[model samples]
Target: RTVTSKMDLLAFHTNTPNESLISSENGVDLSLGSQPLENTKVHFEEKQFVCSECGKGFTHKSALLTHKRIHTGEKPFACADCGKCFTQKSKASVLKHERIHTGEKPFVCLECGKRFTQKSSLHKHERVHTGEKPFACSDCGKCFTKKAYLVVHERIHRGEKPFECFECGKYFTTKSYLLTHERIHRGERPFTCSECGRCFTEKSSLLTHEHCGSAIGCRSCTTGILTLLESCAKDMRPIGFSLSHITYCC
Candidate 1:
């Protein structure tokens, strides 16, 4: 996740074999293995064949699509619960869709056994466990694990705030996010923690606390203190266990 000066998306326009090799557009070279190009039939649209695997049938096209998902696991959607992480938007969406039917949470965190239907939820949960934040913002040093979190973060950097709450004169980058935050002032509790019967104004805070505990304490340099707390809480546990865990997990 290296940040670049360019804000435009990586785009591709179909070109013939001659142009793909000769033209200046050096985008992704999406060639299908060592297979011959003349073998598969192409379906033309607007300019070029928009669908490369058009006549290749369901299995053939699906396999290509599945392969593409590997290159770009563009899971644009995310779960509102448990802060689980995912690569595919559809997968997160499908799980959320199933929530209406089963009302069950399958994905669980390793540090704490919080359950969620989406893997993204579990990922956001694991951040609480290890406190591992690898995603760093280019504008600010503040770190986050998810892209959506980063998008909101970039608002501070770009100073292009489009998300504003008419009710409070507060501004944000995204409207949906601003509306969700506005609910906090409206006395709306959307996320309820199953661990301690505590409710949160937002899902993000709830996910954060499940691992870090309430806001009364400090999270910075707290990993060093956990061993002392463990020793104070349970003398039976060895002193080095916490240190060793943090050393390896960090």
Candidate 2:
């Protein structure tokens, strides 16, 4: 028999103790002395707690409260060594930050036995041994070991120079180049040759000077003459100059 309501089902069960009643709405069997059919439906926990700022829903109130800290800009976890603040999402982040002060390198490479502070760094270092270049440029199809290197390489194809030198108003593709160029303005020759005690702003320049030897007097003067000869050769302008015929006088 079809049962419309809970009361009707109870009344029908009281009248006929042996017969089973089917729900009129959902066609669920309602037998006498049996549990209600409505209670047997699959239950799912609803996300009642929601973030007011971001509209993100969470099943537990505690999780919703923890997520709200992100929108509120609240960092309850602080590093003891450096006093740097981090979110309450994970305490693992705090442990990793503590490694910086403690100088702990837990991640180690199997190939070279080189240790790294973070697992990601260890993974990147492992690529060196494996010769894996996972990150590839879309334009040139050139592969790089790291994503940052690929990003810098893509800038070359686009002719993008984001880093700028304040002193000379010159732009560079990378911050390292801009910093090196600033040394010229500051007259900061950091790279020094041990042989002649001569300083150069770039290490490459110092290496070139070292290769020329102290007997050549000034390497710049010799390089200038060689460069002039090269230019003269390229222009087909015969100056009747030969490197073998020239005297070694600075």
Candidate 3:
């Protein structure tokens, strides 16, 4: 008699005194010798449910339905405060955004006691103490603590300035620079001098004004002061200049 199934093979092996046996199953022949049955690779779960949009396969129907949201752009989970939508897979994104309104920092670092709104932020912050830089640039082999830092470093090698200012059509390497440039177009002077209540578009300009106490030293500050002086001359206003009292002239 021929063994067609694994159970039959096992039972035949136990009863028979043969050192080897030939078994056939699903049109495939198996030579069962002195090798253990545990060594055989037989078990497998087929992915029956397949995505029509991306052609990705999943073992369960629920998983396939969840993955379909990526192609459909369906975000069921939304924040009540901001009404910002997020995918079901990223339910944590909604929670993180909610913490911004609540000012809740649940994740805390044990080493430094620094609190973070998200667990991922806490993990990234812990790297500062651990000195572990996993993300490395392919071109320069320079390692960075965060993957975002590594991505920005790689952009320098590729000369990719993705961030652009819509008002002036100027490109910037980083989003922070683009945001600072946008402040000029908006006439927003957020950085204020404590001494004179003077506002500046950039933090560096504020620092320079604080250090020099006058616009005479810095080039950008001098240009701005010259323009203001030109306006004062047109108005027939007398301007007095001094190092300690620079606000009197303006």
Candidate 4:
């Protein structure tokens, strides 16, 4: 039903199920029927949804797109202050985007006292204490609280690292990660921890530090994270992400 190339969508049907046609030029019109349904005439109203219904309403389709951040779990609206991402791609994309211009840490974590711009991010950060593993891998016995970490874990099983940097002779599992690593050379660190006054080159590094601090850090961070995987017996004793009770030493 779907092709990799461009195609047009066509619509046809009323009250009942009907197929639509595809046209390259003319956009599909999703209009309601004029007929009645069980002694009830079709209202055929503009079909304008209310704000309270969808959480909020926007005047433009693009505005509606911005509104959809409340759903779909998309954070196109990223925070410059703390590198937190939001799903809603805003009209004045400049305002939200510019926050990144000035490093801000307005959003704070009540659990750990870490600050962030996006509430969703604070929620994710808090999971470290709660010891949550909501995202699990079907192929293997592994779990992660964050979707991004799950993706990175999938890449490990897939044995894929798409980005290779020529300058540093370093390879990265993802493009954005590789780009962040490049900042080390550029010295473009925008995130700093308030408690210890430790600055990080990448937001990801900052995130990792929150969980895996050091020997003490990894020990504490993995405490909550490790228990979640014990039932699987899949052996999460890998290098950076997990710990093993026994070390080969050979």
Off by over 4 Å in 4: 1-95, 101-104, 167-171, 176-250
lDDT of each: 0.54, 0.73, 0.72, 0.56
Instruction: State the number of backbone clashes in model 1.
Output: 11
Screening candidate 3 with a backbone cut-off below 3 angstroms (N, C-alpha, C), the clashing residue pairs are: none
lDDT of 4 by residue, 1-250 (tens): 2111121111133223343322222333232232234211112222244455365644356666556556667776556566778565454455535646666657787777888756677789888989998999877979899998898889888888979877787988988878888878888888886655667887766666555433222222333343423432344333344442222221
lDDT string for model 3 (7-101, tens) is 76667767774645554534333345544554433522357799998789987899898889889999887777887877674656666888999
lDDT for each residue of candidate 2 in 54-171, tens digit (9 for 90 to 100): 8898879999988888888899887777778887747678777888989999999999999988999999999999999999999979999999999899999999999988877889
TM-score (all chains, Cα) for each model: 0.38, 0.56, 0.63, 0.38
Q: Could you tell me the TM-score of candidate 4?
A: 0.38
- Residue 149, candidate 1: Cα error in Å is 1.5
lDDT of predicted model 2: 0.73
Ranking of candidates on lDDT, top first: 2, 3, 4, 1
Per-candidate Cα RMSD to the true structure, in Å, reads 16.4, 10.7, 9.9, 15.8
> lDDT: which is higher, 1 or 4?
4
* Index of the highest-TM-score prediction: 3
Compare the candidates by lDDT and give the number of the best one.
2
